[model samples]
Target: MAVRRALALSAVDRYAAMMISLAVFAATGRILGPAEVGMAVLGLTAYALIEVIRDVPTAYLVQQPETSAPAVRSAFTVMASISVLAALMLFLAAPGLAHVIGNDDMYPFFRIIAVALLLGPFERPLVALMRRDLAFDKVALVNIASGGCNAIVVVGLALAGFEEVSFAWALLAGNLAAVAVAWALSPYRRLLGIAISEWRKVLLIGGSSGLWGLIWRYTDSLPQIAFGALSQPAAAGTYSRAQTIVELPGKLLFVVVSQVALPALAAQRRDGRELKGAVLDSLAVISALQWPAFLLVACLAHPLILLLLGPRWLDVVPLVQVLAIARLFAPLELMVYPLLLAARQTGRLLLSAAIPACVYTPVIFVLASYGGFATACAYLVLIPVNTLVGYLMIRRELGVRATEVLGALSPSVLVTAGSAIGPLAILAAHGFRFDLPIGTACAVTVTAAIGWAAAIVASGHRLSPELRHIALLAWRWASPRLRVGS
Candidate 1:
């Protein structure tokens, strides 16, 4: 498939999944209190950390120049083994983990969620092979189907008063849906078999990458975990929600791009092409899209929370704003992992993750004791440090000089400033009140979007050409309909 088509499919999947997830969370947030949400958050945090390890074998398969049937089988076997072990460990540790987190009520939540882990080994290898071939249509189908199932189950159960365990059940339903869809759509069904002969090769390839992913994921889960264990009741849930809101832009961009980037970059490397240009181009596009969205989210956090999650979650507004600001620099490091993986610099990626993990884990744990806001403050200090470390590592591997990187990102800075114009004006007009009327909030969002498009055209950023092409295509498609109506 063409790269543009792949990206478009991925984007459709991500946006659809995002809308479904947002709806589910919105309903659940209203139905469940902070404590219940916090319990779910803790259970999901454990699940997330285990999920990272599952990606290792997938990466190994996708990065290969030629994935043999034996290798694919081995990858599944390894993934399945790891999933079973992790699920077992989580199940056995659930009680103790609940005790450690000072929430005996979370024991069942953890155990129930562990069941979802078993479904990964069934779906991941199939999806990875689809990704390797750039079969985004199938990939998108699997994701949307699974996400829809998850949303339906979660909302239904939450409404039925399942409380936090509703999320656990929803996860199981989603994974089962993913497994079934992936199996039906993937051409690799015949490749499934017991093959431990290639296990060594798979392990060697994915080990460092897996470790890197684990540590990277830890950076996200640590804050919530710490809050769950050390902070005031409901703090973890509030922080989780704020982090979720702040991360939406990044997640949307990253998921869509990275799904394409890894296999595409690996292909580019196999064909003996330079990677620096691709890396820089990715940074430019990601920043142009991501920074403006973050800025808008930061500016409109209050009204957004009120509209989407309701007044009960009003306390999340400030946390979202702070996290949005801190994550402004996040887009800079967005391409680092894909670049490193493409270059087969997995060891360097591991080191990069390790350095940041060591720096932030201790500090975030300390901050979590204070409160949700205090934990959010830690990101202010941590993200820049992490970004710097990641860039330094990327410079050494890809020779991406700081000056060149800055040159690439400068236009995005202008775009972000332009995007902020309408939102900031509205805020000022409203006397900087975080809580604006619903109609006024709608105005802020519309203005921000308009300003963003205007800035993209006015500044002639790298993304402008793509936007122009899309617009021309859109006009062409619409003109025929207009003539028919006339």
Candidate 2:
């Protein structure tokens, strides 16, 4: 119930944030111009490189209970130091990076973005404490407020003709507001202090985890960096846009799970049975929604792009499909990373990520250099191998067998994939015409829902236990109203 509540609040927060972001996007185009907005998006690659500073300290705190004030203080102290140093370093490197990307104007904007690194560490202690107690309502409140504040600042500054600086200033505003809100919600008022022994333990536990963070962040941003270095400017922008389209759903899934999974898993790490049950249930819930959604999106990509993005983005159709499929196999890795975090087995997590980083770092550069169907094919080939290695680690460390995991996911994979057939058929039929109207899309959705219902019946009502429990919960509330209506 706590997890569900957190997820519900998270969903609301994400929706609200998305709306705010849309406003900012609109404002940037109208006021700051598209070029400025594009440059702001380009600057996030630098932020991604420093993102590990945010996660490592949070991990250190989340694993420890809120009562560990000394450790918290030490972690905060070290985190703040790292943030300041990172900001300084990024500011120093901004000119060089801007030069490399051949955009001399971006140097100050990059430096301004680095200021966010300094403030973000201050928020982590408060956030980690709230998450440790499952006090996500407060966290959600803070997030909504901060995101709203960010949009207002960015839009206002852009209207005032701040241009690129508006984006960077908005980042600072957002982080500061978040820190203030999170701090208000926090109970402790611990002063700054650092002990070598405590810092050593945090480093020992979170350092390797931080390495994985670095690897993950680097991989995510490497596409941009590589594209900037190797491909045409238009090519990099195209990849960014296509990625924005394909990764939204996956990124949302990641945000929700990443919020709840570590704390929930950590709470249950003591009992093997409980831990295993949690893992399977989480996987089932994830598979039930994500796999079908990915397939549906893949099948309906052309129609979707036509409707939302217009005819200009037709080139991204195959990339969208390949990435959706890639995300299909992502659960195996995502599920394992949090479990390892709960177990304080960051070494294994690092090992798991390091394998893929080696392969894909080069792959991203190649993909940037040569992007059409060939790039998509390389992704198809490499991502599964990465999943395989991660699964092996999960099995060895957590005693999570392939059979048990598959059993948990099988109902969803079967029924949901079956559901996608109608949508897939509709898209296939319209492929030659390329005239899928909005009504056609609606019909596709309705047909898919019917197919989903039929598949459930055909499967003898085999439902994921997680889904079944949710249904039963809903039924308890809805049954009385239905009885009265009848």
Candidate 3:
């Protein structure tokens, strides 16, 4: 029942948030120029950095199941303090940072977003705590409401001629809304007199996680910075759009799993076997759902881009395709990332995160300078290689064999391939372009449905009893409803 609630609520929140964000981007992109959009991206990048910087304390506070309310509050206090300091420093230094990235216009936008940074600490630990407690329903409600509010505010500001500033303002409004809702729902209130020393236990944990998070941020952020420098703002915006679309499904999956998985794993931390089993099950479920999404996006990149963003975004199709190729491996990254945290493999986690950070940035910069966005994305082809290395390390620590990992993921691969073939054949038979978006969507949908059905059939007619039971229950529930309607 809890899982059902979480799944249902999360699906609603994810769908709503995705639609709202896409709407905001579409509306704003029409109003703002490339440079303004670039600054908007820069503002978002800055905000992400600030949050990464705060990740240490916030992560530690949220991850520790044994932590007392007072201790958790104090950790939040420390993070809040650091966030304020960072925001202030960044606000003062926005001009220099903007200039460093070769965009003077970003300074004002960056400064505006810096105020939103202060709200990050208040919001982060709360959501983290809620996730730790497995209160996903509340989390979903809060996220949907927050996203809805941000979307409305952004559209309003765009109409009011704020242009690029609308994004920054929308972020601030969203964070404010989330913080308010989280606080109202939280058992404890923010205290003005919370002391720093009370947070010593989780402080070190946060600091370590924060350091690793900063490295991960650098890994992801370098592409944007390099693209901005090597290519034009329009090019960077295009790349950003590709990333936004490619990442949407992965982010939705991450949001749902992250909220549920950490606490679930942490609760089973002592039972390594059970924990490993749970993780495998999670990978199976995620891979089954997520693989089709990336495949669809990759197959339909050109049409999807044109349909969603108009002709101006056509340039992003190739880059989006490249990204789609790499994103097929994203679920494993999501699965292993939390497992490492739960296993107290902090040093290994840092090493795993740092390696990608260290390798990806310079490669992108050099490639972008020599070639273009597509070449830079070519670097990401190595992600599967890196993911293999990560899982090997995780397996060693968890005492699970590589075969176990392979076995768990094998079903998903078969199902995903089965589902993808129909779409590929149909698209190949009738070229990539279609007369109508609706027609393309329908074709893709039918293809995927056929593929999934084939996959279930091919899984040897002895499907997992749990899944079989679920199908039976679903049919039993639906048949009566169908009859009633008839």
Q: Candidate 1: misplaced stretches above 4 Å?
A: 1-8, 63-69, 185-193, 231-233, 259-274, 471-486
The best candidate by TM-score is 1
RMSD of candidate 2 to true structure, Å? 3.9
Sequence-dependent TM-score of model 2: 0.83
Query: For residues 1-486, what per-residue lDDT tens digits would candidate 3 score against the true structure?
Result: 776676667667677778888887777656665566766676687688777776566667566766466776777788778888988998999888777657776677778788888887677777777766767777876797789889888879978988767888888898899988888776544432355666776677678778877877777777677766653555566667788888877887787777688768877886644577788778887887788888888777777766666776676777777887787766568877788888888888888887776667666777766434655376466577667767765877667787887888788888888888888777777775533366776788788977876686677322345556888999999999999999
Ranking by lDDT: 1, 3, 2
* lDDT scores of the candidates, listed in order: 0.85, 0.72, 0.74
Q: What C-alpha lDDT, on a 0 to 100 scale, does residue 276 get in candidate 1? A: 85
Error of 3 at 252 (Å): 3.3
lDDT of 1 by residue, 133-171 (tens): 878889989999999999899889998988888999999
TM-scores of the models, in the order given: 0.90, 0.83, 0.86
Candidate 3, residue 370: how far the Cα is off, in Å: 4.7
Candidate 3 or 1, higher lDDT? 1
C-alpha displacement of 23 in model 1, angstroms?
A: 2.0
Task: Name the weakest run of 10 consecutive residues (lDDT summed) in model 2.
Answer: 230-239
In candidate 3, which residue ranges exceed 4 Å CA deviation?
A: 1-19, 29-35, 63-73, 121-142, 229-231, 259-264, 272-284, 329-331, 370-372, 400-404, 432-437, 461-471
Report the lDDT tens digits of candidate 2 across residue range 1-486: 877887777677777777676566545545643345446666777786676755576777777854576788777877877888888988999988777666787788888888888887678777877877777788888888798889999988988888867888888899899988987887754543554448877776677768888887776666667756752444554455556666766666777677778768977776544577788878776776677777767766677766645565576677777777777776675687888878867678887878888888878777666754455566677778787878887786667788998898787777787788888787778773534677887888788777776666576444434446777899999999999999
